[model samples]
Target chain A: MTDYSPLLLSLKVAGISTFFVFIFGVFFAHLFSRKKFFGKSIIESLFMLPLVLPPTVVGFGLLILFGKNGFIGSWLLNWFDFQVVFTWIGAVIASIVVSFPLMYQSAAAAFESLDARMENAARTMGASNWRVFWTISFRLAWPGLLAGLVLSFARGLGEFGATLMLAGYIPGKTDTIPMAIYFAVESGQMEKATFWVVIIVALGFSTIMWLNWWSRRNIERYKNDNA
Target chain B: MLEVQIKKKLPHFLVDINLTVEDEILVLVGPSGSGKTTILNAIAGLDHPDDGRITLNGNIFFCDNEKPLPTQQRNIGYLFQDYALFPHMTVEKNIAYGVKKMNAIEAEKRIERLVNTLGINHLLSKYPHQISGGEKQRVALARALATEPSLLLLDEPLSALDSRTRLECQEELQRLHATWKTPFIIVTHDMQEAEKLGDKIIFLESGLITKTVDNRSGKMIC
Candidate 1:
C-alpha cells in the first residue's frame, strides 16, 4: 500500500508557506513599484536573489541562519525552546523563501502597470492612502496578484533541496512529495517514486492550465467593451 | 474663494503664477508644457510648489510655514483628461466612492441628484469600459462633484469629445457652475472654448502668465 502522508504533508507545507509569501510579496511589491528611495535598486535585487539562486544555495543560507548554532536558531532555542530544523515548520520556511520572489515579481509588475492618474483621482476624491490602496489599487492589480499566487503556490509545492537541508525528510512528518520521491528513487522503490512524480506533474500542469484559461478569459472580458 | 501664489522650477522655465478665483470660472489657456496643468495640480495638492501659498475658502492648503495638507484633506474635485474613472467599478460606485462615509441615505440621494442633473441616470450599473466617451465624461464629472468639494479643477475636460459633444458639455459645465457655485479653475488649449467658459481668462507662455483677460468686459486685466 502506498502511503499518502507525503502528499498530504507537501500540501500542508506548501499551503502555509504560500499564504505568508502572498502577504509579504504583495506588500513589498506595492512598496517597490510606487516609491523611490536611495538604494532602491539594491534592495529590490536582494529581494529577487532567491529566484536566481540555486535551491541548495538558499538552503545553505537558511541553514546557517536557522541552525541551532546560528544567530536566530540559538536565540530561539534558548528563549522559546524551539528548534525549526528537521521539523515540518522548517519545510514551510524553505518553501516560503524559495517561492517569495515569484509572487513579488508578478505583483510588482501588476502594480507598476496601473494608471497613476486613477490613484491620483482617488486621492482628490478624499480617499486616504490606505483607502486608495484597498479600494482602487488592490482591486485593479488583482489579476496580476492572482497570477503571482498560483506561481508561488506551485513553486512551494515543488521545493526540494531547501526542504531537504532544513527539514531533513522524516516519514509522516517532514517527508514532502519531493523528499519522498528522492528517497524512493535512491532506494530502488520505482513504483513509489513514479507515483509521487506523476502527482507533482499533475498538480503543476493543472495550475498552469488554470492560469492560462483565466488570462484568456480576462482578455476576452476586456476586449468585449459592449459587454 | 481660491488664491494661489506659486513658483516652481519646470524643465523649460520657472512657473511663476499669481491668481485668485471667487465663486466663478477661471480659465487657464496655454499651449502644451506651458504649466497650466501644473498650476491646477499644485492647487489640488497633487504637486508641490517651490514657494507658494494656496488657500481655498480661508483654509491654508499649502504654505512655507507648515507641512502641506495631504490631497485627501484638500477637498478639491479634479476631473482628469482621460476621466480616470475606476474601471473595475460600476458608474454608480465610482460616483459614490468619495461620499461613502456619509450616511447611506444621504449619499444615495446626492448621487441620485448628480446623475439626474448630469443626464447619466441610466448609466449607474454600467462599467466604464462599456460606456461611450461622452457618457464617461459625464460619469467622471458626477463622481468629482459627489464629494461637494470646495474647489473644482478641470484639466482639458472637453478636449476628448467630438465637436457636438464638446459644445453640449460646455453648456453643461456652465449650467453646473451656476448651480454648484464652487470656485472652478479650468485648463484648456482652445481659445474659443476659453472665451465661452471663462469668467476670467489667463494666458500662459513659457510658465508665465503673459495675459489675464476679464471675459465679462473683454478687457486685458494684465
Candidate 2:
C-alpha cells in the first residue's frame, strides 16, 4: 500500500504557503500598481526572479539565506530556537517564494485594468482611501485576484525541485508528494510513483478547468452587463 | 458663497480664473480642455492649483501655501459625466456611502428621502449595471446629495443623455435646485443648455473667463 503521508504533508505546506502568499502578494500588487518611484522596475524584477530562475537555483538561494549559521537562520535559532532547514517549514518557504510572482502578476494586472475614475469618484463621495480600496478597487478586481490565488495554490502544490533541495526528503516528515514520487521511481516502485502522479495531475487539471470556467463566466457577465 | 481665485499651469495653457457663486446655478460654458472640468476638480480637491484659494460658505478648502484638505473633507459633491456609480453596490448603499457617520435610523431616513426625491425609490435595491443611463444619473445625483454637501459640481452632467433624456434631466435639475437651494456649478459646452439651466453663464476660452452672461436678462455682465 502506498503511504498518503506525502500527500497530507504537501497539502499542509501548500495551504499555509498559499495563504501567506495571497496576503503579501495582494499588498505588494496594490503598492506597485498605485505608486511610482525611482528603482521601481528593479524592485519588481527582484520579486519576479523566482519565476524566471530555475527552482533549484531559488532553493539554493533560500538555503544560503536560511540555513543554520546563515545570517537569518542563526538569529532565528538563537532567539527563538527555530530551525527551518530540512523541515516542512522549509518546504512552505520554498513554495511561497516560487508562487508569489504568479499571484503578484495576476493581481497587478487586475488592479491596473480598473478605472482610476471609479476610485476618484469614491473619494469625492467622502470614502477614505482605505475604504475605497476595500469597497471599490478590491471588489472590482476580485475575479482576477481569485484566479491568481488558485494559480498560486496549484504552483505550490506542484513545487518539487525547490522543496527537494531545501527540505530534503524524509518520509512522513518533510517528504511531499513530488519528493515521494521521485524516491518511489528511484526505488523501482513504479506503481507508487504512478499513483502519486495521477493524483497530482487530477488536482492540477481540476484547478485549471475551474479557472477557465471562472474566466469565461466573468467575460459573459461583463458582456451582459454592458449589453 | 463659493469663492475661487486659482491658477493652474497645464501643459499647453495656464488656467487663471476668478469666480464667485451663491445659492444659484452657475454654468461654465467652454470648449473641451478649456479648464472647465479642471475648475470642478480643483473645487472637489481632486486637482491642485499652482496658486490660489478656494472657499465655500466661510470655510477654506484649498490654499497654495498650505496643505489642502483632502477630497473627503471638502464637503463638495461632484456628479461626473458618466455617472460614476459604484457598480458593486446597490443604489441604497451607494446613496448611504458618505453618510456612514449618521445614526442608522437617520441614514435610512436620509436615503429614503433622496431616493424618493430623485424618483429612484424603485431602484434602491438595483445595482448600477441594472439601471438605465437616466436612472443611473438620478442615482448618482442622489448619492452625491445624500451627504448634504455645501456645494455641488456637475461636470458635463447632461452630456451622456439623449436629447429627450437630457431635456428631462435638465428639468429635474432645475426642480431640485429650486427645492434644495444648494449652490450648483455646472459645466457644459452647449450654449442652449447653458441658457436653459444657468442663472449666470461664464464663457471660457483658453482657460480664461472671456465673458460673463447673465442668462436671466440675456445680457453680458462682464
**Winner by TM-score:** 1
Error of 1 at B104 (Å): 2.9
lDDT, candidate 1, residue A137?
95
The reply for model 1, stretches above 4 Å from the true place, is: A223-227
Model 1 Cα displacement at A161 (Å)? 1.3
What is the clash count of model 2?
Answer: 0
Looking at candidate 1 chain A, the ten consecutive residues that score lowest on lDDT are: A218-227
Error of 1 at A66 (Å): 0.3
Deviating ranges (above 4 Å) for candidate 2: A222-227
RMSD of 1: 1.6
Residue B113 shift from truth in candidate 1, angstroms? 1.4
Q: What residue pairs are clashing in model 1?
A: none
My TM-score estimates for the predictions, one after another, are 0.97, 0.96
Q: Write the per-residue lDDT of candidate 2 for residues B15-58, one digit (tens) a residue.
A: 99999998999999999999999999999998899999999988
For model 1 chain B, give the 10-residue run with minimal summed lDDT. Answer: B100-109
Chain B TM-score, all predictions listed: 0.98, 0.97
